[model samples]
Target: MSRIGKMPIAIPAGVEVKVVGPKVSVKGPLGKMDWPLEEGLGAVVENGQLLVNRLSEDRNVRALHGLARAELSNIVLGVSKGYERSLEITGVGYKVALQGRTMSFNVGYINPVLFQIPAGIEVKVDKQTLINVKGFDKRLVGQVAANLRAIKPPDVYKQKGVRFMGEVLRKKEGKTGK
Candidate 1:
């Protein structure tokens, strides 16, 4: 048995978790989200607490036990408290702008890199250098931030470009001229 999977998830007030066949749905003050359970895995809500159980002991099923519990836990937490990721821009001429649902990044590129915001996610830009990504889906929020960071990862030489808040990168020394 997986230690994490055996743990019960405490459902907060105004939050409801339901298991319908292979799908697990959560509704809370923030929003509602659903995900399908893996094969040979089952979930049940007991006395306001949700529990995940394995229906089979197959190799793959055993591997998914802990993962399923964690994902469900995140879903419950996200809908209730939500998740956020912050990004910082560092460079001489690197900045980001949001117009409507589109985000444009000017990271030393000839043309600004454009990104379209997906549904159920919110992004806020502060002073053109700080970006805060928020959503009820942890995975989606994280993926969006990673995508933005991928646009212009920090340079080891100049330590410029887009990166996560508090993310550290070692700077490299430049070659000296004779």
Candidate 2:
């Protein structure tokens, strides 16, 4: 038995969990999220806690048992408390601004890059260089942050560009003249 899968998830106050066949939906104060149950895995609500079970101990079932548990845990946490990712701009003249649902970036590019914020996610700029991405879905928040960082990834030589908050970059030495 998987250690993680064996543990039960305690549902918090004001949170509602619904299991319909192979689908589970979690709704809380923050928002609602749904996940499809993987094959050979089952979820049940008992005594105000969520439990995950597997049909058998097959190789594939064992692999999915832990994954399903983790995913379900994420869903419960997301709807209740939400998730967030922070990024920082590390170059001169680089800044970020939000106009409605679109975010414009001025990261040394000839033309400013405009990225539209998807529904259910919020982007906030602070001190013109710090970016905060918040959403109920952890995966979406992380993917959006990655997409923004990809716009101008940090350079090894200058260590300049967009980077996750607290992320450390190794600077490369430039060639010396003879």
Candidate 3:
């Protein structure tokens, strides 16, 4: 038995969990999320908690047991409390702005990069250099953040560009002239 899978997830207030066949839907104050159950794994809502069970002792099933539980827990938490990722621009003249559902980037480029914010996700800019990505789905929030960072990844020489908040970059030494 997996330790994480054996644990019960406590359903918080204002959060509703519904399990229908191979699909589980979690609805909360923030939003709603649904996940498809994997093979050989089962989920049940008992009392005020959610439980995950595996139908076999197979190694693959055991591995999926914990993964399914964690994914469900993330869905529950995401819908209830939400998720957010912050990024920092570290170059001169680099800036970001959020207008409506579009995020405009001016990172030392001739033409500003425009990223259309996807549905169910919110993007906010602060101090012209800080970006905050918020959403009810953990995976979407992270992927969006990664996509934004990929626009101008940090430079190895100056460590300049977009990076996750508190992320440390090791600067590379430039070549010396003889």
Candidate 4:
């Protein structure tokens, strides 16, 4: 038995979980999300908790057991409490602003870079340097933050660019003149 798959997911208040065939639907105060389970894996709710079970003991079936459980757990938690990712901008004039549904990144570029915000995800800017990406889907929230960070990943030499909040990077020293 898979350790993670054996663990039951606790359903918080105001959250509703439904298992329909291979699809799992989770709804809570934040939002609702639906996802299909992997083949040979099934889910059931009992005693206010959700459990993932495998139909067979094959190697592949065992592998998907934990994955299905984790995915379902993420969906439940996301809908109940939501998820957020924060990014910090470093370097002079490397700030961001939200214009309508787009993000304007001014990271020492001739023209500010632009990123369009997707539906179901919200972006909040604080004083132009800090950014908050929020949504009810953990994967989407993380993907959005990663895309924003890719705009100008941290510099190895100057350590300037967009990075996750509290991310530590070692600075590479420049070549010394002979």
Residue lDDT tens for model 1, 25-81: 999998999989998999999998999999999999999999999999999999999
Q: State TM-scores per candidate.
A: 0.96, 0.97, 0.96, 0.98
Q: What is the lDDT of residue 166 in candidate 2?
A: 94
Scored by lDDT, model 1 comes in at 0.95
> Which 10 consecutive residues of model 1 have the lowest summed lDDT?
10-19
Q: Give lDDT tens digits, candidate 3, residues 79-125.
A: 99999999999988999988899999999889999999999998889
Candidate lDDT (C-alpha), each:
0.95, 0.93, 0.93, 0.94
lDDT tens per residue, model 2, 73-157:
9989888899999999988899999999999999998999999999999989999999999999999999999999999999999
Which tens-of-lDDT digit does each residue in 11-41 have in candidate 4?
Answer: 9999999999999999999988998987888
TM-score of 3: 0.96
For lDDT, candidate 1 versus 2, the one ahead is 1
Q: Which 10 successive residues of model 4 have the least lDDT summed?
A: 32-41
1 or 3: which has the higher TM-score?
Answer: 1
Residue pair clashes in candidate 4: none
Clash number by candidate, in order: 0, 0, 0, 0
